[model samples]
Target chain A: MRHHNIRKHLSAYAHQECSKDEHNIIENHIKTCIKCALTVNEYQQVANFSKQIPERSIPSEFIDQLKRDTLKNIEISKQKHYPPFRRLAFAGIFLLLIGTVTLHIVNPKTPVEYISSSDTLKLDEMEHLASILCNKENLIAIIDQPIPIHSLIVTLKQMKKLNQRHGQVNNMFERIMHQINGNVLQEFPTPLSSCKIGGKFDESGLTQMITCLRSYQRYNDTITFRYIASYYQKIRS
Target chain B: MELHQVIQKYQRPMVAIACRMLGNLEEAKDAVQEAFIRFWKSDTQIKGDPFSLLCRILINHCIDKLRKQTFRRFFSITEIKDLDIMKSNENPHKSLENKQLVDHVEKLTTRLKPVQKAVFILRDMQGYSIQEISDLTGFPENNIRVNLHLARKNMRKWLQPILKED
Candidate 1:
């Protein structure tokens, strides 16, 4: 091999990292090549000097501090994973309450009752009816009524439109109509009961019912003529 | 092995490797401590040698620190400080000479890329075999060899004038 080729391996050569055949070639080359030999010597010297770099003995205090810090970190991590008894108890109770509320909303205990045609409701009774339908205390009862799945879906869509309109239009005409005729009408149109649409009371239907009631309560501040008009519009449509 | 025992047994050597890689004892200690904490947090029932695993963790941590230091150095105006050369009471003259040699080595090694510095330190300073370095660093033996060769070549170039002056 040329001197240049042999010179490239000099670092590995100093460390004896070369193959036996390569080592023999380099050794023979170095015997005749003074420059290559000098380069090899320099490489060896660098390796030797690096080896002589003293290892620092860790301070005893540093070890103690590291142990304390590491153990403290481990303890903190352990606490993170396994919470304390009272905190765990609080979490458990909080979860139980949430689960109970969810279960009550999902599957109410109040049975479905059919409203008779003679049980006419006055317009002034809308507020009382809304309170019964949308009140948190009566939420389970409202969800328990056997609402037709199709009607609930339709009502949910209408209620969403009403909510969007209520946000956009805050005119005096609508507000005045709401205040004057809000409680004076003579009949509460039971659109839910009037619809005998055949459908199963499934999860989707219950969800729609809950959503409609939620929207009704949400827009309670403006539960005026427009809302009743929207109901009538739903009936006519 | 238990964690405390592992810390007690391997702390010195691991810190030595980190010191060489980082060129600072305090940073080395921090890196070694971080490695130990990571080992504890990780699944300890590791498949292979625990020491090698710990070495791998420490080395990677040091490399990450070096990268961040390089980045900070790039944007910041601060100058790099010289390493704290260890002093010896037995023979102050010999200690000063050794200190100069160490300072020169530290300066030369810092010029190398992180991986090259790591390979050079592991092979030349710490006396690890190429294969062991491969296992510890997860780099192929050929890659380690190339890095070692480049690192040594750089060191030789830098050390030639110093050696001649001596």
Candidate 2:
């Protein structure tokens, strides 16, 4: 190998990746040539120092914020028309919400029934509702009487499952409660309790409460956490 | 648990390469952030060697940013600052007197073509083999050899006096 050839292959020679023929030629040329030997040493030092340089670390705050920003962008993208992949994600979310809510209403673990005057029902029905609604694992909150606490729990559970269902329940509560309170002002809906339905539980008013609760539930409120998703992959022993 | 820990552990060499190549702490920081953001967002598989993949991304991003006129003007302005660069504890200079060596390396880096700068950073500074350099840059082995050879020759000519004295 000539000086130029040896110099060109010096990196390969250092890495020991040169073919036997090329390696031997370079080795022979370097032995007989002082300049080639010096050049090889220079390449060695450069390669060595290159290894010593450390990789960079970006700030944790920047990364965390970037992920949040990306997620926000993804959410915004869903609202508008997006590319196919993102459109798919938006469709998936919509489908998931519809599926969960429909399942909750259609195939509930406990059948829903209304309380009425005239019939003296068995305590077994109330006990079943209590067991289904008031159980610590199931209840998000309790509400005023006349509408059994179990009914409220069942509705709340449905609301927790889907934003649309939550809105529906909120409207139902406000309309029915306002009518009852309007008929009997002497009853509850006190100043302190009035905020629960904003002093006039109209259909719209109940819808607003459900909306507020939905917002909280959507973001994850501990007050209504019946089934917390576990994110831990494994717990170290 | 935190992003910084991952960067600190896997990205130190990449940061060092960018800092050495760009010779600006702030720009190096930005380059690293952009690279990790790309990594975090990308569905690309981070197989085998995370460090190698990260270094490639960091260098490539920095190279692109450095190509911008605004960043070039910024570099020209910062070049006049003559600040003493701080070294990470792990990167303490073997010879404090070799400040001249650092200067020589920095000057030679500016003369390298963008791809050559990346190739040199990966092979010489980041301790990657030619094959690994090829993997990161998507260059053929022959092309890598040519660029690396030219890069080494340029550095040798520039640093000849400094190395000889040391």
Candidate 3:
């Protein structure tokens, strides 16, 4: 091997890493080569000097302290990163829940909302009354009872007139009208129930009224028709 | 593996490497401690050798300290002293001689560029094979070899006059 080749292998050679053949080659060559021999010596000294640098004795107390301190720091970081509470909860989702709760709590000043329109407020109140007055069974019964077209028209007109004046109709018919009017307050006059018809009529009494109204419908010239006609005419005017 | 286990395994070697790099025992301990702390905090897995990754973190921290040291030196600030590494009540001649050699070698190392110094320390001082050094540092073997060669040559310039006595 050339001098440079042997020099490259010198570190390996110093560590006894070279193959027998390669080691012999360097040995024979360097025996004649003064510079190569000195170079090997220098490499040896370099290795020895580095190894001679004493291992700084880590104090026994220092080792224990380091372990204790490191464990403490690890615990702190783990807690900051993932507290036990967060681990029990649904990880990232818990953070989102915390943020949501914090947001709700941060802004506690809920402004009182005012109805911009009195008409709208009244309509909402009427809608609420309709919901409460017309229970599901009562609504279903009124719908199931078959009123002929004439009774239906007369009942609607009377409901409209009653809503316009008192809005205090008996609960039973009031429920029926509220249901039939599609729960729209405008469909009946405002202030429902013009006068008390004693107490509410049961299903049978309501059927009787439907029959009477159907008879009355034939007399289009009757006073009731005149009154109904006059009311519509007045609304139109 | 548990974080304390990894720290137990690597702390001494890491502190040694950091001491050589930073030239201050306390600073080296702090740097290695920080490395352990970082390893504990990282959610990453140790790909191959846990100790190698920890050394890499520690060496990077040492380099950052060296950079800060440079900034301080530029301002003519006094550097940390109290670099006593010898065992007390030993033979005075051997202790003083070893101290002088260590001082001279470390002083020569400080002259070398950071990359070369690290390569030299990894290879010569720490007894890491070139391949192991490459694996630990992510440097190509050729780059490590070149730096090691340069670092050794630089040190030889400082020590050659004295090694003639040996």
Candidate 4:
């Protein structure tokens, strides 16, 4: 090694990490080089002195106590972080409460007369269906009652017309009505999908209804009346 | 047995190592305590020596703390004054002069860079081999030796005045 490298490795030389050849070179270089010799000697002296400096004395009793305290603290910290279980339980309780409320609203005591293939849904039936939805707090037309094609047809027309007039005011209910209408069409196919109210009973029809409703919320009443009047007229024809 | 039991076993050595690095018993204890808490909370699969893993974690924790302190010290001149260069307790086993010497030595160590200080504590004080330090620090063997050499040189300069008086 060069003198510079020899100086750097002197601590190692003092600690005896050198091979014979490397040791001989550093040893010879240090002997002639006074600066290297003094520096190496100083490094050796410090290394020896450091060995004598008392190891950081940690009292065993203190450390044992520390371990116990840390163990206790760790448990506390874990509890602090582990709040999800409680939150999940709260969520479960909330869902159960909603399910109960939903069961009460969608009860079977008020039996709905489903329209069969030979029968036509009368104007009273349409009025009853509209009143059931329009009177409720959350006015979406999913009543959980057994529904025939004619009543559903009337329900779709009323919802579409209501969406046109008042949907902007009650945006959430309008969206729900839209989703339920789509689901009924996709999941339950019917031959008489369109109603006498001149509504297409599809997503586009709902959008037009919402646009018309957006013009004036009161326009919904006129749309609803015409919707029922046209359905009866078409069925009579 | 468990992580807590493992802490109970090796905590003294870990504390000693931290005390040397941080130069304060309370901070050292905090550092060691945090290391165990973190290890217990960790998802790491310990496939090797648990003792060695814990030691590495403790050292890294101390080094990180020191690095932050160093950064803060750079912006504020008074910050360095807060370093509590520790002193030995009044033990019947240790003489006053011995405590003075150890205390003086610790005071000298406060001037060292964090890496050099860690290397010195591990190699000289803890009697760890050069290879072990390299493995623990993930520094090259040569790098550990270089820091060890610098640490010794720095301590010697501090000791020179005392040594001459003696």
Prediction 4 TM-score vs. true: 0.55
Q: Count the backbone clashes (under 3 Å) in each candidate.
A: 0, 14, 9, 5
Candidate with better DockQ, 1 vs 2: 1
Each model's lDDT: 0.65, 0.54, 0.61, 0.63
Cα lDDT of candidate 3 equals 0.61
Residue A180 of model 1 has an lDDT of: 25
- What CAPRI class is candidate 1? acceptable
Q: Is candidate 1 or candidate 4 better by DockQ?
A: 1
User: How is the predicted docking of candidate 3 categorized under the CAPRI scheme?
Assistant: acceptable
**lDDT by residue (tens digit), candidate 2, A22-117:** 989998988989987877787677655555444445576744554455445545544674567987998999999999999999875432233322
Report residue A46 deviation for candidate 4 (angstroms). Answer: 0.8
Off by over 4 Å in 4: A81-237, B70-102, B160-166
Chain B TM, per prediction:
0.78, 0.67, 0.76, 0.76
lDDT of 2 by residue, B63-115 (tens): 77656535554543453332223222233244444544455456556666677
- TM per prediction: 0.59, 0.45, 0.50, 0.55
DockQ of 3: 0.31
Q: For residue A144, what is the lDDT in candidate 3?
A: 26
Query: Looking at candidate 2, what is the lDDT of residue B3?
Result: 44
- Clashing residue pairs in candidate 3 are A163-A189, A163-A190, A163-A192, A166-A191, A167-A191, A167-A192, A168-A192, A168-A193, A169-A193
Residue pairs clashing, model 4:
A163-A210, A164-A209, A164-A210, A164-A213, A165-A213
The per-prediction i-RMS, to one decimal, reads: 1.7, 5.0, 2.4, 2.2
TM-score rank order: 1, 4, 3, 2
Task: DockQ each candidate and list the results.
Answer: 0.47, 0.16, 0.31, 0.44
